[model samples]
Target chain A: MIVFTMLNDRFILATNLSLMTQQTVIVGTLAIAQTLIILTAGIDLSIGAIMVFAQMTMANLVVTSEVSNVAGYGWPAALAIAAGILIAMVAGGVNGFLIVRFELPPFIVTLGTLSIFTALTLIFFKARTIQGPEMPDAMTWMGTTFKLGPFTVMTGVLVMLAMYGIFAFILRNTAWGTHIYAVGDDPDAAELSGISTGRVLFSVYCVAGLIIGIAAWITIGRVGSASPNVAPNINLDSITAVVIGGTSLFGGRGTMIGTLLGALIVVVFQNGLALAGYDQAPRVLAVGVLVIAAVALDQWIRKVQG
Target chain B: MSTVPAILSGRGLVKHFGRVVGLNGADIDLFPGEVLAVIGDNGAGKSTLIKCFSGAHAPDTGTMEVTGQDVLFRSTHEARLAGIETVFQTLAVSPALDIAENLYLGREIRKQGVLGTAFRMLDRKRMRAEAGQRLQDLGIGTIQNISQAVETLSGGQRQAVAVARAAAFGSKVIILDEPTAALGVRESARVLQLIHDLRERGMPVILISHNMPQVFEVADRIHVQRLGKRAAVVTPSKFDMKDAVAIMTGALEVDEADQALGPVRTPAAV
Candidate 1:
């Protein structure tokens, strides 16, 4: 109630609302990917790094330089973007392969890959930022907004929604989805039931990679630049949103709708804090509080329901 | 009497978990339309032998034949495809999912159109209906909502769901690993009834349990495993509870002549 009054007095409610939707696109997209991984009782710390690396690839490919003009030499925008997404998928596939083939834990595997991907991004881009005028309109297309009622919605927001919609259907109404939940719930039970848990987990990681790549494109659009240094804490932020969305970190019990709400809650809190003159410290502190509160709430609900 | 061919047989099955011996030349033969109870003290290779048959573990040295044809199982999925299903002691049911979803966890039915072929949409309505029907067929009509999550169900209901799933898909044989180890007395009785139902349906069942009453109640032939091998095979009428326990603990031994005589009156039985 106090926050609402402050917003009304400031009269920047509409602006804040629009900014929240736009802000949600990046973290919200990452949370979707995180949802899949967490559902399998796994985590991917490399999500943000994978997104950044893919964005850099997209940026460097289209903004041609003398030394980096391999594919940028008159390459079509669609082809470059496709190649960027493919590169992200390949990186994700490698993570899956290492995990399943070697029987390593997802935590350690993704942690190692996170550093490797970040280093690869820095080495490839020479720790440089690709900025305005060099970025093509095709790459920045997601930034374009249209009026919906009194609200201005960005194309990236629509893309995020569309992704959520497609995956919601898949997770709720498919054999693969059931297998995922089964594998996450109890791997031994799943194996005895004849579900190939390794294949399920491997596919989940790869599909999460695909979603993260799409997020990379959205990140490029939102920032209007491809920078290695942007959203460095995005990995933790995505996990925060997922956990706050009521998805259990332990796996097998969450919804896409909950994740979307989680993303909205995060953006709303940050926006409200900034509007009220609170600095970055309070904003980060608030997110940490929300994460713990959400997990505690989940435990309570489980006990009551069980 | 005409002989019935065994649906599944293992000869000299040997398995070792690292340095510990799980099975030592364990041999088993599962006849058709019979409930063969494999019971023993804890860690007497009952589960190991079942795992070998169900493809969860490969025998270090042994040969398995399904319906008289030798085959090798690389994984549980292969064993399932070859018409063998196992309900592990853990119940092997995903608690978060609904009863219908758990029923069709690994083998979900898909829609018969482009939505299924291209998009892989599941036929949820059909699956739910079939799941309900399957449970009812197994005489488990107490489950009112097929969409209720398995975690919400009672212990007996969950066990019923596991048994129903095995009975639905297991074409050749269903191997149950202590299906009632965690159930209440009433629930245990319900499970025993379900086992009897499966037998009446002509589905061979391999019941692994520590409960002597349950073993004697439902099992047509009891395979007493001792020291990682078959100690003796006896019917409930031939060997009383005392004799069965004595044989399992190696307190009583049957000589070759007495074994050849088959179900002879032992001193303990008197």
Candidate 2:
């Protein structure tokens, strides 16, 4: 896509690059959480909902003026930011608990919680969008950009990259990390091997929640608003990034680096297509096609025959 | 009869899964330094019997003892803690994980210093080195890379990794549930040899198999399970393959007093 776009119009390269990085920050971070859950053979449909809900919470807590009698706590920005992250984490924990405790399929549990969290956010915050000016500097700090050599980079992008690096290391170098792969690969086998599959699963959801909470903060920074309805397609976008990144949706066969590239791939396609004079429909169509191809590719790779 | 006591034993173990009676008062005994092969027809409670012993299921009534002490395993981890390792029929290996990782799937070795103590970082170097040494000990020299994914391995090598895992940590008993049921003939032979080598190490092994010849080759005593109960316990030397099969098919019955039901060997000389 980059080469084709460059051939079409090389002048748009720098603009497209900047737009892609800025656009990918939120989804990129959320994809980290999604990748962790997917690694355990679980899908989280409530990721975007959790982020929006937490962002709303932070926005409402710090709003200095009353809107429609829904007065903000006028609280400190740091506490509100922490509160927002806490809500996101708790929301994530709830998703994990429901799936683990009831043995519910993660798809159904998160699908249901997706509505519940979204609804709760609307009901509590009165469907009001908190503008960027009202939000604390800390809440929008991730949007802060600086020059990195020849590139102008969003701080949120760096945060997402750091998250990827940390989780990649954890997966490669920790006992818990190996257990996650084992549990994801075969929960029954993990159980028989004396690994507490349940504990591993529960912790995975909780840790994924922690990452999602940080994503909430990043989203607030990048989008410059605390709207309950921001990034409506964000959840599917994150899943798309993970799938395109070559992490098997079937579970234990992908890398964190793949997800980063996956997120980049999505943004690159969208930004490149738009710059190449393609309509929004084509970009969406392209991502949909990429998802199918990625999953089909995973199926082929997993059939490593002896 | 040998005067030495049974190293691991189960008395009147009964397990029920919904309405299906898995183990209808099944009994099992494993003597020290002897390979006791557990054999039975389908639904005769062969797997169920071992599940109870391996902590996959808790028998409703029966009791299990290891090294003369009563042990109740609520989970497989508890069973491992009590030194009863089981190589399940499924091989229980994560194919995507590497050889060393599968060997240390549940029990991973952590790194030294704060990186290990606080950060929970794995000692990949130590694990790979030790896993290589273990495969070497098991005579599994075919696998050259400790980091090679198990999916890339052959059936025999995968079986070798599973058995090696059991042999590494199984202090009191190593229970193999049809270790070679899915392997080729050569692979089956290697696994049978693994059972032999484990027995040679003075480890009591409970082998579950349907192959009569293989069972006769490695098992010191054959445990015939019929109708979710212990039909009879006979040694390969005392009863031929036909006799064991007859006992399994319920066409022949051996009185409890006639059963060998004792260890054929003492401590390992090797």
Candidate 3:
């Protein structure tokens, strides 16, 4: 109530609220993917790097010389997008394969991959940004806005929501979802009960990679550019959203609804702070405080319930 | 007792864990409609033997036969497919999931149409109903809510869920590793009764336990393991608790004279 009162006092209008929802697209989609990884007690620090790499792949494939107009065929925007997503999935597969086959820790694996992918992005794109006419219509289509009853919503926002809805169903009412929770809860026990823990973990990484690919597309649309430097803090931000949404960092306990709400809370906090005349430094500080408080509250809840 | 062939058997099973002998040439046989109690002192290779049968660990050297067919299991899923199910001491359940979900953790029932084949949706309603029925069948009526998370249940209830899961899915054989080690007296009795019920249904059961009275109360035949090998296989009517304990701890040895006494007319003194 106090925050709402402050926002109202600052004359924050409905348009600002709609824009805040729109702003949630990129981070929100990434959070969904992060939720899946975290549910297995795993973390991916290379999510931001993967998304940026995928976006660059999509953009450069469309703009490069003979690559765009190959074999007497016009530039294929759809092929570029598919290739970008496929690359992201392969990257995700690599992470899963190494982790599962070798039994390596997810944190260290993703940490190493983060540096590797960032270097690849730099080498491939030369740290250049693709903007304006260089981006094809198919690539920028998600950025277009559609008006709905006194509010303008971005297509990208709808796509994010759809991803959340589809995955929420899959997690709730599918055998694969139960297997995921089982593996996260107890890998040895799951294996004894006839679940292949390696297979489940490997598939989770691959699926999360596919989601990150979609997040990359959203990043391109939201920023109106495919820049190697985009979403530098997304890996941490997605983790924040997932943790704030009531998913345990230790894994095997969380909900996608909580994640969506978590993403929204982070966005709302930043937007509200900016509206209330706080600088960028204070906004970042507030988010830091919120993350700590949310986790502390989660610990308290666990103890109380026990 | 019915002259039925051994449904599952292992011979010359051996497993070593970095200089610690898990199993040293342990052999086991389970007949139909009988409870074969495997009792041993701590580190007597009881767990190692069952693990070999349940596919948790591959024996360094051994041969396993299920229904007279030679088989090698590289994974527990394969063991389950071959009609061998194990209820581990840890219960092997996801506590955060509901009772129904835990019951169908790996082998969930799916919808019949495109919703299942294409969309991969589960038949939650049917699963819940069947899980409820399975619990009731095992006389686990205390769990009023089938949808309740396993973490919220008591220790005995958790054990019941594990036993019920094994009994429902286990076809030829069910191996239980210390099913009542963590339960209260009443809970242990309930689990013992479930074991009896499984035997009555003619399903072979391999029960690994340290409790003497429970073993004497249920086992049709006792397999004493000592120093990572099967010391002797005797009936409850032939050798009493003292002899079983003496053999398991290696304080007493089984010679040809005792083997020739056919049911051992007199109980041997420790």
Candidate 4:
């Protein structure tokens, strides 16, 4: 009985580790879209706003949009995803237009849109939070308890892994991926090589918006409600994961695997610190230190190679 | 002596930067299995002509033909489709990427899945192997690893890789602008040999240079540009560096103005 109990204790610890791992993966997928945007030598300060906007839009659609005439559960779910993604695309598209067409610096453009998108999100909710429908029996299956051996995994985890895999494939295999790297490295040079830098930037922002939609889906499923004010520090965390993952903020010098590793590091450290009773101040300090260290290490590696 | 449609030919090419004439009524024929050197002082429209051929800017006037077919290229991709690749003086390579990755930067070959899905990603193994082989074929056996990023390569070696990429991608006509302008004597000589080797493989090469010795060394024919027009096409056997300079600076024509001032400038596209 003692031996069996020991084995069960060990199994529980392992399961907890796996659960943390799943959460890190979820965070990593959200960071990836941002990583890509940064890789193009551009910044998307509005990622947080975009993510929240997607969540609020989808939550309202599912709950308040009433199961009126024709469309039912299946249709609502699909339409919610589609609408969330579409809204994000339009938001991202506006960002793209301001940057590409107006010839404005991406930093200023995104900074302005960051405020605009947040305001838009608040407008959607009428300055109030949206409570998503009580997890439907079928929809609840996605949020159902998952077990891999002794470890429980959420649907969010699986979806994150799948998205990461897709991202890795797209970055590695497709011509579009090549164009992304090309545009990020040197827009003028890439243009000379026949890669449309503006188009690449536009597409990246559009894809970024789509990823926000996916993130919203996962967030709603995880929390069972959409609050615009939730996780105010998420944007910073996402950026921290991306930078620590080894994707250069300067662009054209990062990997999805690196970013995933980075996200895991960020989450694992934060969770472990929390488990050990560290305060929020120390956690924030560590993340800031991590960003600096990653950037310095990258520059050192580049210099050494030279 | 032999005809192959000049590989790439520009007729009546005109480009203007809002009244500042970059290239005005210029024409040039780049022949395969030969090096045609374009030489002039600054503002002779050499860069403009090269850019037009490379699809950087659409010519405001004139036609570009490749392999004898009139092509209207709006972008470099169009020029690439017609097997015309240009190695700009800036090199335009991603120093962050490895040698092989840079070589296959745009035209990466891969496996396809059912219904045209991308299954096998970037055939990297094959690319590395082929990149090695191609480099060796171009007489570049000194590179230890194709995976080493280009930032690690020497100036001459980077230029070699750039040229090798253009050559490997099936560029029938390779246009290089001042490729060795920044290299030292030994490095420049090494680059010149690569240019010569390119010709031996039946690929037409356009070598744009300011160095007369270097130009006379590799070029089979030298086309001298004087004030946005090609004034002379002289073979290496009958070339005079001083006379070429005089033509390039329009000094020869100025000297002849006292004797007879006529449009004797044939405007030949060599």
Best by TM-score: 2
Cα misplacement distance, residue A178 of candidate 4 (Å) = 3.4
DockQ of 3: 0.81
lDDT by candidate, in order shown = 0.85, 0.87, 0.87, 0.76
What digit string (tens of lDDT, one per residue) describes model 1 on residues A167-212? 8888999899888888878888888888989999889988998998
Ranking by lDDT: 2, 3, 1, 4
Pairs with backbone N, CA or C atoms under 3 Å apart (clashes), candidate 1: none
Candidate 3's C-alpha lDDT?
0.87
DockQ scores for all predicted structures: 0.79, 0.84, 0.81, 0.44
Candidate 3 residue-wise lDDT, A1-306, digit = tens: 257547655425658767988889999999998999999999999899899999888888777544332121234789888888888998898899989999999999999999999999998777788783565788888888988887888999999999999999999988899888888888888888899999999999999999999888888888888888887899999999999999987889999999999999999888888878889999999999999999999999899999
Q: Which ranges of candidate 3 are over 4 A from the true structure?
A: A8-12, A65-75, B1-3, B256-270
Q: Write the per-residue lDDT of candidate 1 for residues B153-245, one digit (tens) a residue.
A: 988899999989989999999999999999999999999988988877778899999999999999877888998998877778767889889
Alpha-carbon DockQ of candidate 1: 0.79
Docking class of 3: high
On the 0 to 100 scale, the lDDT of residue B259 in model 3 is 34
Q: Residue A266 CA error for candidate 4 (Å)?
A: 2.3
**Candidate 1, superposed: residue stretches over 4 Å from native:** A8-12, A66-74, B255-270
Tell me the tens digit of each residue's lDDT in model 4 across B1-270. Answer: 233346678878888899899887887877657788899989998988888878888889998888788887888778888888888888878777778777877777674554135354677777889999999988886898999888789998889888887878756788899999989888888889988887776677888999999998988778777677776677666557887898788786433222211111122322
Rank list by DockQ: 2, 3, 1, 4
Q: Which 10-residue window of candidate 4 chain B scores lowest in summed lDDT?
A: B258-267
